[model samples]
Target: MTDGLYPQLADAFPALASEIAELLRADGEPLAEAVADLPYYGPCTCTATCINLLTAPHGSSGSSMIQLERDGMDVI
Candidate 1:
């Protein structure tokens, strides 16, 4: 869990991080491992549905963004 990829994601939501790795592994173990090694930039600014991983910094424009939800709502 300390390969250093997605450290923030792993530290914040370990389960979600593991699930992402598992999902990626569906394509190939190497692919998953490789992606896991890529840096997790930060959250997205748009309201589009996604895992919330970005590759570059995009400053917010007062738009809503969701991370982990709990009880059907955003929690973190």
Candidate 2:
């Protein structure tokens, strides 16, 4: 549960969805089908190397801060 999902953000930031999809694709992930509708409680409040966005996984995986991984094999 979060304030909202990525779709709402995507609607506001036109290029956001495709950009994320492209990143996921480049990382050997399929066409954004999995995380396309993930909810975000808010941005991370830490100093990690990420966009500072916090996402909650549905089950035991718990929560994590989202990072845009690149080049050296990106994985969620």
Per-model TM against the reference: 0.43, 0.45
lDDT of each: 0.53, 0.53
Per-residue accuracy of model 2 over 1-76 as CA lDDT, tens digit each: 2354443434444376667777777656664655445555455555566564444532335544445666655543
Winning candidate number (TM-score): 2
Clashing pairs in 1: none
lDDT of 1 by residue, 45-75 (tens): 5777754556334653435432444356543
TM-score for candidate 1, please give it: 0.43
Off by over 4 Å in 2: 1-14, 47-50, 57-76
Clash counts for all predictions:
0, 1
Question: Model 2 misses residue 5 by how many Å?
Answer: 9.0
